[model samples]
Target: MAPTVLRLLLMLLALLPTIGLGNNAAIADTDSTPAELTIANRSIFTFHATFLGETPAARAQRATAVIEEALRGTDELKVSIDPLQNSYLVLLGNRRAFIVSPQDLEVSGGDTRVAAEQAAAVLRQVVDESGEARNLHFLLKAFGLSALATLIFLVLIKGAHLARRKLRGRLPQLMRERARQIRVGQMPLFDMQFVYRIIDRLLSLFYWVVVLLLGYQWLSFVLSQFPYTRPWGESLNVHLLDLLRYLLDGILQAIPGIAVAILIFFIARGISGFSRRVLERMARPGTLNWLTEETLQPTVRLTSLAIWLFALVMAYPYLPGSGTDAFKGLSVLLGLMISLGASSMVGQAAAGLILTYSRTLKTGEYVRVGDNEGTVTEVGMFNTTIRTGLGEVLTLPNSMITGSVTRNYSRAVQGRGYIVDTVVTIGYDTPWRQVEAMLVAAAQRTEGILDTPKPQVFQTGLSDFYPEYRLVAQAVPSEPRPRAELLSLLHANIQDVFNEYGVQIMSPHYLGDPAQEKWVPQDKWYTAPAKGQSADEP
Candidate 1:
């Protein structure tokens, strides 16, 4: 045997119950700190105190050598103990094996001689077993028993495979017959193949776990049949039981805490449902004007999220493993990750909430922000989607919207319509009254332009050359395509009116006076492309 194995064996024996003689093995040791004397890997007795300054372990080692030599001889082993001053001598046949001091004896009234006799009795029993283990008949019987156990183990392993095959054959059909589609409404969450793979993996894992347990039992049983390996076999059984008990107890102890945490979450869910219904009722038109069907959605989600988060805090102590360092570390890691990454996301969400609650923006309203002008298609928490009449879609971040100048054209209108305005810089020669009247006439002639409020013209700026005239009008038909069409018709009418009135609409950006005038006559108004071909594709 390896020296490491021998040392481990000796250390392991120290942890086991000390062997006295017969019933005395159970006797409580008060004064003795004994060292074990093992034969054939089986512990027979113990020695206490050093003989001639030798330690208890050294004396036990010497005694074990003496006992082993006696067993090697042809004569049967004879054990006896002789009393002496302050100690007793354990004798193997006529040879002195070792001495036992008061340290090896129980504190009871029994003398050292009586203790030595008990020790002799236990040694006799152990020596007889060791001798029998070496006998041919005994060895043959042990080999047969081991062979029988091996055969049973092999048969069982084969049977397990057969059972596994039988299970595999029927399991798929059984699972299919009992399977229910996991879906939300008409949509299947996943395909059947995904479920099958998961089942197959679980089945294979269970099969291997059972096979390993069976192998452990078989090996332990085979080891237990021989005297030399019996301690190993017994240790396996004891440790396995201990491990299982620990796991079972831990699970049992954790159940109540887990149940409490689960119960808290269920209660929170109930509260959430109730709060949602209450919030929905509170979001009616008269209840909270800002919380419309569209705007109320964010509030509902936030309320639910807040409730769940609060519930988590309340139930954290009751959660299994919550007190463990690993769970605390995981929570801190998640918090750090969120704090590091969510700066922009949080700003966007806050802006969205402000936009919704303050009624600053609404879906389907025409708005111009920065250089992008379109109808708001969706006002989401992080981004707003706008679809332009020019066939371009814009996804603007909420934070960007909050930071830039915004012009809402549809908010002040009574119905589904948007404001339309066009700027014209006519020469100083054209009268401001004529310019305003002509612009109003153009707007009145255009289709879809609302007339109830009447269009207005503003001389917004008086530049060095001419005045900048802006014609502002309201147009019905909130749809984006109609707005573009109405603006086109208005521009066409303005050109026709200016031509019919014999007034040349000239840009006032010239550095010098023109020779005559920069005017496109009525004949060329519908230039080759304006009538059919693309005038200028955007």
Candidate 2:
């Protein structure tokens, strides 16, 4: 047993030289040739030898001797017996030459001079059988190892795919159950459905990535044993990993901005809802109108704007161009543009603010500006709109309104009565006392005139043709449309009263001469009472 082991070890040692020689010869051939060389002039040489030898090495030695014998008459196939060459040469069919190195054979271009001679020698030595046996063994071993590796890779990929499918199938049902529970009780931290979907998608992505990575590693391992694909596989691995790294970086960068945007949207919605409720409550009957007008809407708008601005600032780093020089330059340019164009807008806004705080006129208030009298319908930052009784709407800039004189009739008297006055003309023949009584009675007879304040009559002017009397009446505060009606009624009543008193109203006549006497009704009716009666008997 000891001798058998020692002999086996010696045989392995003896084969080491042939392996070394084959490796060196392969390297030398590859180094000596360019990579672009085609297989155009290739040749194959087979050798079969009937060796009457006792050992395998001796048989191989006899095969080498047969190959050398075939090369003797061939000029192109030179058989060098040098120990360093560790090979023999032969000519093949006169088309090519072969160098049978220690463990491999090389073929090259040669002339067709020694073809018949080499063929005869090969036939005599019988070289084909030994070479065919060696080639068949090598090809069968390579094919078996390749088939085993492919089978293992396919089984691994198939198992991983099956596992992934099973997990994916179970995920949806579990997520549905969890979502139902959350909906029935309270809201979860993240929306249950959304979170579950995100998790499932991430898991799916991870599973595919792991599968792909494992496949790639296995392929790289298998390819490393190959002579052609080893270098290319390493480069592909680096590019694949770089792509995955860039994808991860992009996802990470987007997460914070997406979160911030969602948060801001929800928060703004909540705040807007709260503010609306508060405004509705405040706008209810009997609440302070000033609070609704001055505080609620502007506060809500400003708060919403501020929240969005803050969110934008917080998300700036995650914005695509926020950190770039172009963004900074654009910011500056936009600011300059706004400054150039916003001066009038700023002025109008300031004026509007002043108008709101001043409370000079509100919507639905009757106002008169110069000759324009109307009801205010809208008040904007830049303009105030009014609808006139004549059915015309007028838009006035805030700046124009601020510098003009405006009379607000609604604010003149809160709950007090409004005064409506009318004027009349009568001859001097009418007694001043009687005129005063007649004017007061006329105002009292008019509809919508307040009797408590008592209509007043003042002698406004005493012209040469007539004496002008002003009749003023008070109206109820709630009666807005009664002023013109009351005035018309009073003038009609005055005409009737003056006619009853026989007082001539001198409206059309101007005094042409003082000598033309205006008639006195009392002078015409002057007759002395009958004598011999009691003195007070008129």
Candidate 3:
């Protein structure tokens, strides 16, 4: 029983120094059984101990507090150890001491005095290391490294500038030589100077990127030099690497979708092109006999646009952010805006489609729409452009054209030649045969009047004072000549024919006949400046 009591006491002594007095009362509350005691900063171990009872815990707590107080002081720390009653004494300078038992030494497999001395030496070393004076050397080293980094950065910038200058001087000529080798139908595919400029910008961007990375690394290194700021440096590096990794992962994940989208784009493009080609071939004069040439191109274009729109809709879900709420909101907003703003555009497109399919008007045709009479130059989705004989180009909205009267003169000119008619009143005294013969002569003399169909004269109306002599002649079928000019020429021939035949054309309100006969004699037909062929000829 006595031996067992001794062993219990020895074990109790060994365990006491490990637990602090502040924590001894809370040992039953704590789940962790602490076997060692370390200073607050955890830079060094103070001693080996255990959680058991009050007496030794109190002694250890007091000694640790004394050691910490001594470390906080300005005086130098000195340690010594000695045997005391089968245990050991660790002396801090000449004032304070801590006890180490044989059981404590046995826990670490060492003699009691040796263990006490070692613990004292560790405490002293820790106290010295905790002093603030030693950080100056590290601070100075950090400054030196920062200065060296700055110098290297400046040197790199200078080298980059020189390299940029050299590349700018020589790259354009080389690009031009290379571009000259790539030709399409005798025209260079790409502009050499433009390509060189693009490459120069990319190279400059690369250099700036390198410079930025170097600066970031230098900054990180400088920050990591101090213990306090080292965590921030580590965090910066970790964040940058994480961001890069995330971006790379996203790119890799999106590659399949991007490939699918590209494939759809190429397929749609090929289909549109092939369909357009087929439509073009069918539009030829003697091909598949489908649509007319005037309608085929517009139909093909509209069909291609519809196909591409459908393709885009199919490809939408595969786009990187198409499923995102922001993308959805943007699409809705855009669609709303378009719906609100495109009323007139819708009307114009509808009219254009109708006009195209109806074949009421065609390009290169002479047509009169409302007050605007001209040759149709362009028929667009929204508008139609016309070039008049007066050299004015008129752009009219398709909606307006659909609402107005469109007189296509070229439509009549397709088969039979266009007929030009003029009416004149004559007195009853003049014979009808003579009047008809004179009108025929005038029609024959007109430059653009067709000869084969011949001119025909009609006495369509008789009034109280005179008879209406309507003379009609065939002109060129919608030939690109001024109608006003042709009318002027025809009128001039009629006047000369009348004046040569001594027939007075002023019979619309003939109250009485003129006394001396208001007629121009045949001899005076070519009078004065009217020097040309005689008007009396057949």
**Alpha-carbon runs more than 4 Å astray in model 2:** 1-252, 268-320, 324-333, 414-538
Best-matching candidate per TM-score: 1
TM-score of the candidate numbered 1?
0.68
What would you estimate as the lDDT of candidate 2?
Answer: 0.60
lDDT-superior candidate, 1 or 3:
1
- Largest lDDT belongs to which candidate? 1
Name the candidate, 2 or 3, with the larger TM-score value.
3
- lDDT value, residue 53 of candidate 2: 19
Per-candidate clashes, comma-separated: 1, 3, 2
- Tell me the tens digit of each residue's lDDT in model 3 across 1-538: 6434544555465556466534453132132232344443332223344323434445556766887787667777677665545666666665445666554543446676666667777666555555533568867886788788778878887887788789878887788788878999789998776777789889889878877887787778777655445546766798889989999998998898888988898999999999998888788887754478779888898989998998898788888888889999999999999999799889999999988988888887778899997778899989999987677899999999999999876675434345567898988888989999999999999888777677889999988877899987767763546655777788888888988778888654677767877877776767778787665776
Q: Which pairs of residues have clashing backbones in candidate 3?
A: 18-49, 18-50
lDDT of 1: 0.79
**Each model's C-alpha lDDT?**
0.79, 0.60, 0.74
Ranking by lDDT: 1, 3, 2
TM-score of each: 0.68, 0.39, 0.65
As a TM-score, model 2 comes out at: 0.39
Q: Residue 419's C-alpha lDDT in candidate 1? A: 92
> Which 10 successive residues of model 3 have the least lDDT summed?
25-34
